[model samples]
Target chain A: MAEAKPIAGTRPLAPKPMSPHLSIYRFQINMILSIMHRVTGITNYFGSLILAIWIASAATSEQAFNTVSSYLATPLGLVILIGFTWSVMHHMLGGIRHFVWDVGWGFSKPAVKFLSWATLFGSLTLTAIIWGYALSHWGIR
Target chain B: MPTTTYRTELKKVRGLGSAIGGPGTDHFWAQRLTAVSNLFVVAFLVYTGLTLAGAPLGEVKAFFGHPFNAIASILVVISTAIHMRLGMQVPVEEYMPHGLKVPFLFLNTFFVIVIAVVGVLSILKLFLGN
Candidate 1:
């Protein structure tokens, strides 16, 4: 087939704009925070599964409940619980950030930075307070 | 001579079509709806976890047996299951290889259903057994 020539008097079409690639951007807090939101979100999937298992074990029988509870009381289990708590807290804050953006707020550069940092520190503080309360009240430590 | 185009204005505004030409809008709203509900449900979950920490089996059962607690537990399971399934679909769609993508998406939905069913049933058993 012969190549079709452009109409002699027609202006050439401009190239379409391409979406920016992730590798092209410099590192920023918001980038990491955005990725962390997805990571923590995925982590919570397993955390919810464990929660289901815990409830199922309790419904099974006293012996089964005791076995699950005892395992949860162990050091490794405590570590897992703490990690889950942190993930939940972090993800919750991230969700709130997304909610704020969804409502057409917090899109400015400074606002984005503030929200990202707040999510990180706020989650840590919340986790610490929760574990502190648990340690003092429940004698977990 | 006037140049002509056949695409609708809405399609033009939407730019690129949705992935796989499916109900992307429904998925978007469903995810946000579940996210909104999960925000509250998760708080109740944390509260339950704190209160039930290291409690004896009888006490634990009694707590779950309470009407409000039982209902709240079921809601938490269902909301989180839906949210996680929708959330996981993003990663699966983006990262999974072409051959594995469809299978993983199906498995993602299947896994969430199993979780939600087992969780709701267990809570119901405890609620009724009380």
Candidate 2:
């Protein structure tokens, strides 16, 4: 069979479809929450590495364990640890939000806005309570 | 009646389903499965963290020496590693340029393996009194 070709100079010249640009849209609560979800997820990657190191130090020797413990006692380490706690909480809540959506619920605008705000406040509240209990009960090493 | 179409019955069906084959639901299902498992395991992890917060090395060792704690610790490590790798791949696939995407994805897998191995081994060493 002979293949047919378009006549010369007769093909359509419509522009290709382009993706929506980020800067063109006004920022909203959901946008911040979504970006935060990604940010905290990446943060948890490093946090997991730190956790591995903490466990490895304990397994190595008491000296090794104390070395990590003392470092964690430092203000900077405490800040990082606190930040990691918050990040984990935030990401976990965000994951739950995603799961809720996956199950085909919470697509309504009000539900979405409520969930986003709830995730933010909920994470902060959990982080505070955890740290508060830890500090009051354990007293930093 | 004369036929007007040239495509074979097979050709018409080809490329109609998931490009990755099977039900094409592997990634979707795996991601959600890990996500669900992670919710439980990670709660255990946080509890472990809280209990061990300022614990000495001996205490820490004793804690994991318990069978349940040791098993839960391993579960947390494995589940988190799988979930993180799957989650991270989304950003790498979406934002990374073609030149860097493949390498990033490979590195993501490699990194997750390292995390899981190191975490589980450490817990085992402590649990075993090594």
Candidate 3:
């Protein structure tokens, strides 16, 4: 074996630690919260498109408006409507969290966890409350 | 004589033509500003939507005919369209490969414009009874 010489005034190679991707990291609240934020955002785009369609239908004619509304009142349509409602609520709460982080606060470990949980549960709670009010007053059975 | 430290020549050429540049912070600010505005506009939108859902056609038209509801609906559509465009632009720019990114960016802009136009026109038609 040949002998190797050490170089002068040179630093030794150091292994840089790569941040873990999705698989390696332990499951955390913020992970799901962040992913759901993006999911809800994308979903909201389609929901907004539907909303525009509904508005346009209303503007077209009375029969057109009733046609759209009748379909939306069906079971499958209600499911889609509820899903979109939840997405909007979740995305809005998640957006508020992002805004707080943008202002340079809520980066602490506890704060992050708190905000994530709050977003998740707050959205669900608000959605339920709104739907409850909706069902009670609107007689949507 | 001592030379002056001012770069008047550089200042004159800055932001003059194709070589123009900016800090590009306005995009960030605009996104955040629209997001904030959307918070309120979206709430109003939900309230109005829920109230009008499955109602009689004339009732729905009368509801949207109100100036407050009409203005709020317009604001919601405009703010949300801008916010949606900016939001989608980020993912398309960051995650998509180079070739795909360009097409997606163009699509994003077109989609937002279409949504905004349709939404605004719909609301206006109701408000104007035309």
TM-scores of the candidates in the order shown: 0.85, 0.86, 0.83
- Candidate 2 — which residues are off by over 4 angstroms? A1-16, B1-24
Q: Best-fitting candidate, measured by lDDT?
A: 2
Against the hidden true structure, what lDDT does model 3 obtain?
Answer: 0.84
The sequence of per-residue lDDT tens digits that candidate 1 reaches over residues A1-141 is: 223343466433334345787979999999999999999999998788788889889889888888988888899999999999999999999999999999999999999999999999999999998888776767852
lDDT of 3 at B65: 93
Model 2's DockQ score: 0.46
Q: Tell me the tens digit of each residue's lDDT in model 3 across B19-105.
A: 334424656777889989999998998898679765787887898899999999999999999999988877787789867999999
Using TM-score as the measure, which candidate wins? Answer: 2
True contacts kept of 3: 0.52
lDDT of 2 by residue, A1-141 (tens): 123343465442234445787989897899999999999999998799889989999999999999998899788988999999999999999989999998899999999999999999999999999889877767755
Interface RMSD of each: 5.1, 6.4, 9.4
Could you tell me the TM-score of candidate 1? 0.85
**Cα deviation of B114, candidate 1, in Å:** 1.2
> Which 10 consecutive residues of model 3 chain B have the lowest summed lDDT?
B1-10
* Winner by lDDT between candidate 2 and candidate 1: 2
Model 3 clashing residue pairs (backbone): none
Residue lDDT tens for model 2, B29-126: 88789888988998898899889988998899999999999999999998889889888988998899878999999999999999899999999999
Quote model 2's TM-score: 0.86
lDDT digits (tens) for residues B1-130 of candidate 1:
2654444445566876664455787788889999899989999998898888878878787887899999999999989998999999999999998889999999999999998998999999988883
